[model samples]
Each structure stands twice: as C-alpha cells, then as structure tokens.
Target: MAEAGLRFGIQLPVQSQSTIYCEHWETEAGPAELAQAAQAADRLGYAYVACCDHVAIPRRLAGAMGATWYDPVSTLGWLAALTTRTRLLSHVAVAPLRHPLLSAKQYATLDLLSGGRLLLGVGAGHVPEEFEALGVDFHRRGAILDETVQALATALTDEYPEHPGPRFPFSGLAVSPRPVQRPRPPIWVGGSSPAAVRRAARLGEGWLSQGDRVGDLSAQLRLIADVREQSGRSGPFAVNAIPPALYVGEPGWDTGRHALTGKPERLAEALSAYGALGVTHLQLRPRSRSLAEYLEQLEAVATDVLPLVRS
Candidate 1:
C-alpha cells in the first residue's frame, strides 16, 4: 500500500561487487539469494526493485567496482517471477545498445509476464568501449537514443504507428504486446545533462538523476521545469537522486547537501531534505568492506534507514 503522500524505492546493485565472485553468479542472483533479497524487499514494503544496466564498467572502475554485468531485463523478469508486489525497474538501460523494436517487444513480454510491473528507464550510454564491443557508433548513440525514444513511444501506441526515425524505422508493423501501463510503462530518462533534461521533458514521465552534484541537480531541475512548461506539462514530476558514495565515517557532516554518511538519524534527515525538495526517491549505494559488510549495511538500511525515510 502506498503511503498517503510518499513513495519509496530501493535499487539493487546487480553488478559484481567482488573481484573473485564467480561468472555464473553474475546474471542470476544465484537462485536462493535472489529469492531472499526479493522476499526481504517485498516484506519490508519497498515499492520497486530497481537494477543497473551496464555492459561493463569502464576499465578505471575495474578495481573500485565489479566487472560482471547482468542483464537487467532478464534479472527483473526473474525478480517479477519470484516477488509479487514489487514493481520491477531498471535504473537506466542503454537505449542505443538494442533495437528499439526488439526492446519494446522484450519489455512488453516482461510486462505481461510480471503482470504490468515495469518502469522502463532509458539512457544514452556513456561508455565508448561498450559501444565498440557492440559495433555501435558511440558518437551517434545520443542521437540514436533520442530517436529510439520516439520510436518506442510510437510503437507503444495503439493507433497507426509509423516512425521514419534515423536510428529505427518501421512502416506499419503491429508491434504486439504493448506495455501494460497506459500510455506506455512510465519511461524515465536518465543522466544529468541539458540534452538529457530536454529528452526527459519531451519524452519521459520523469528524470532519473544518477551520480550528480547538488548544484548540477538544481540547475537540471530548473531546465526540466522550463522544458516541461514549454511542453505544457505540470507539477509533480519525479527526480530520483543517486547520492554520492556514502561511507560510515565522514568528518563534519552538514546534512544539508549530500546525503548523510553516518547514523540512521542523520541519513534520515538528509533523505527528508531531498523529499522536501520534491524528490520522490533516493537511491543509495551502500559502502561495504566485504560481502558481510554489504549485507550488514543493507540490513541497517532496510531496518533503520528506510523507516526514517518512510516516516
């Protein structure tokens, strides 16, 4: 049940968090672990189960972040199969990586399989190496993402769907199994750029602000507002901010800017401040010393951090 005036969401970091974690466990959450995480999140009343979509993180983050990349759609389909209530979402699937028509079909299939639980988050991918791996032109990916969104919007419609898009082209093919969500499954545009803001306003239900500065977010919000107003849209749009890496010990915490890094009460205050600014969702990546530490942090977040935000 949704709170009277609040909604909370938790994003799962599906990427490999370990250097030696087996490759087979990369995609599926090992069956038992997936079940446990899903059951736990569902039991705790989290609204959505979100995941990141990356073919691979840049070489620089090989040590800092994990290497194994999981397919979010397939993983979400599995999550949906296991969990009943939690809506399945991808933080941002790289749009230029797949055929828009194919993605539409796949998501529609997933939506049907999940009983209409899908929030399709799309983005113009940033990694040039991944694009190279896929044989896609990295230079043209932004344009491809733009046109991909348009093609998707058109394909998800009921009426005559025809798009002579530069990235995707379809004449009169009936793209079957349209998304269960009316007017399409709540497309949220990701990335923090003027172009991204414009793309979100022009073709999205909201903006997915990932790994950005507070000043950058404020400016982007302003740009979103201007674009939305120009396009005759109104208030109550969402902005889900992914705060900076929050560690347990940081000196002189102000609690005004970045999300808190210390106690639950402090983190709660930071969440509340974002909420006060009309931020509907706060997605945090827990700092972990080990797998044990990750689970400990997740437990604390589920028990202590989430409740304060909920309140």
Candidate 2:
C-alpha cells in the first residue's frame, strides 16, 4: 500500500524552484505547468505533495535563489482544489514570521477545505533580510521558532485558541473553521541544525532533513533515536531523507554524474538502503527537461520501481 515499506512524497517542482534543487525546465515554467505537474503527482499516488515557504529573497541571495518562490499557502491551496487523496505539506513554513493565530487560521482553513489533508511542517528561518524586513529579530529566531511551534500546536488544535508568549499574547477570541482533522494536522519539523534536531525530537511528529547526505542521514537518524530515547518521548516520530538527485531511468543526456541512473529496480535497490537505515520517508526529485519528462519519471517510479522495493 505504501510503496512497499516506505512512504514517498515530492516537493512540487514549480512552487519553490530554488537554484539548489531547480531543474532547467522550471526556469521556463509558469502556473499552467505547475498545475499539470501537481495533478500528475496526485494521479500517481504520491503520499503527499510538499510546498516550500519564503517571503522574500535578499539581493545578495536572489541569484542563487532564482527569485521564484510562490507563497506556500496560496500554492498549496490552489493545488488542493485540483487533487483528491494526496496530503499537502508546507515542507517547512517559517512560522516565526507571522503570528501563530494567523498561521493557524490560514492553515486550518486549508485543512478544513482540503478534506483534512494537511501536514504543517515548520522550521527556524535562515534569511536575515527577510526577518529584518518583517521586524522580527534574526538572532532570536531559534527561540522564536520553538515558541511558534508551541503556539501553533495550541491554536491549530482548539476551536477557540489562546497564545500567551512574550511576542504574542491573546485570549477570549475564537478562531473559526476548525481543522477537519480532530486534534490538528501533523507537524513535521525541518532543518539540519543541531537546534532543529532537538526541537523535532522534543516537539515534532516527524523530522524533515534539510540537506543531509545518506551517510549524514544515517548519523542523523541515530542521533534522533538517541535524543528521543534520552528525552523519553513516546509519540510517533519519522525520519526523512533527500537522496542524491535521481534519474529514474536511462537518460539520453547527462543530467549529472551524481544522478542515480539505471533501471528502476537498480534505483530501488539504492533507495532501499535509506529505508534500511530507518528513514520512513523520502522527498525525491527527478531530472527532467519538461513537464512531460518529469511526469514520465514519476510514472516509472510508481510503476516499475516501488513494487520491487516492497518485494
């Protein structure tokens, strides 16, 4: 049912094509192209479709970022109307930028409207300029993020939520459109910093690895295991891995030397290594030059690869 043993999801291509993970085709992409890709993923049985969050890019980082981030809330909401089963995720929303009540209202509406399919992944944001422009102190972001997660957990779960924190204090006000999911959606914590890992261990339903390699993932998994055990946390916890750039099948051109290219079974064999190391989910990407090519890759993974891994 779950592609054998592990659950897999993709960060939809056009939403936040940062240069680090951007494909050549994304530069030429627009809303139509994005909708097509998101719909295809839904059809192909991906466990979830993840969107990224970033308010603005500083001039210094714009070149590297490609300046093409669509707001996660708007993008996810747009695509949610088009798909049925697959869950929607903010791969890592910057919760510190906005008050938790606002975040709760927006995402709770998303969950309510999307038939309760929402996983609210959150993170400590990294951009100095973005935080400065929003009037939040950058150096205090880690603490702020911790508090934000606590606040969001409360606000998302209760019909009439209250948050009493140094930055935000409120009560006696009711937030409407309670999430369709009873207690609230799952909160997966993101980032690879030491602080982030601890927060996830202590607070999150899952850990979203930012940029850790396979070797790094194994170590991170071990560390998380230790942290959870040490803290005596008994709730459900998940470990995520973003593998090397994947090429689902033989390619006519060089996508890159690091690309995992070969038969689907071969690729599954490589990916199973991550599963063996206790990773419960993977956020995979494919190398492609067009939406058609990308969808083909998705189809191949769904058809040819996943079953073999399960076997």
Best by TM-score: 2
User: Model 2 scores what on Cα lDDT?
Assistant: 0.85
At residue 8, candidate 1 shows an lDDT of 62
Candidate 1: segments with Cα more than 4 A from true spot: 1-6, 16-31, 56-65, 244-261, 289-296
What overall lDDT goes with each candidate model? 0.71, 0.85
Report the C-alpha lDDT of model 1 over 121-231, residue by residue, as the tens digit. Answer: 999988788899898999988788888888877777653579987657788787787677777777789988778878887778778887676546667777887888888
Q: How big is the positional error of residue 116 in model 2, measured in Å on the Cα after superposition?
A: 0.9
**TM-score for each of the candidates:** 0.82, 0.96
Report the C-alpha lDDT of model 2 over 208-234, residue by residue, as the tens digit.
Answer: 999687877766776777888888877
Reference-based lDDT, residue 292, model 2? 90
Cα lDDT for residue 131, model 1? 92
